[model samples]
Target: MNWLLVIVGAMVGAPLRYLTDRTVQSRHDSLFPWGTFTVNMAGCLVLGLLTGAAAAGAASSHLQLLLGTGLCGALTTYSTFSYETLRLAKEGAGRYAVANVAGSVAVGLAAAFAGAWLAG
Candidate 1:
């Protein structure tokens, strides 16, 4: 049941991520991967909140698995982020690549922390 929930959550989260990426890309002309960044940040925030809620006994274990393992795992794409950064670097957008990596890591972490704190 837990695994099923996770799978369902992933199905929903992955499509949502893809759609969001496409929407942002279509709307923006910047070379920077704003879509990926936004999704990751949002995922971090949600994961933090879910974790905090779970820890506080406000959420059930199934909810945790569904949100954290499925939704967050799908939404927060480290692989995509890494690939984009590497592609940027390879394409000679070294500054953008570095900024992407640095900003995502720094801000994502902060967002997670903030979400956790707020949820708590």
Candidate 2:
């Protein structure tokens, strides 16, 4: 049952991630990988909220497994982020690569902390 919940969450998250990436990327004219950035930050915020809610006993274990593990696991892609950054650097967009790495880490952490604080 728990596994099923996770699978169901992943089903939704994977497609949603792809759709969001496409939509965001389509709107951007740069090679900064805005789509991946948006999804990763969103996933971090959601997972943080889930964690805080779970800590406050507002979220069930199954819900955590579904949203945090399965949904976020599929929604956030470290490999893609890494690949994109590497590609940017190799393609002479070193500044964008640095910005992506630094901004993603800093903003992602801040978003996660903010979500956790707000939820808790």
TM-score of each: 0.96, 0.98
Per-residue lDDT of 1-120 in model 2, one digit per residue for the tens? 999988988998999999999999999999899999999999989988988898899999999989998899889999999999999999999999999999999999998998899899
List lDDT for all candidates, in order: 0.90, 0.95
Residue-wise lDDT of candidate 1 within 39-112, one digit each (tens)? 99999999889878877889898998888889888988999999999999999999999999999989999988
Error of 2 at 100 (Å): 0.6
Q: Which candidate achieves the best TM-score against the true structure?
A: 2
User: For residue 53, what is the lDDT in candidate 2?
Assistant: 93
lDDT of candidate 1? 0.90
Give the clash count for each candidate.
0, 0
Candidate 2 ranges with C-alpha deviation above 4 Å: none
Worst ten in a row by lDDT for model 2:
47-56
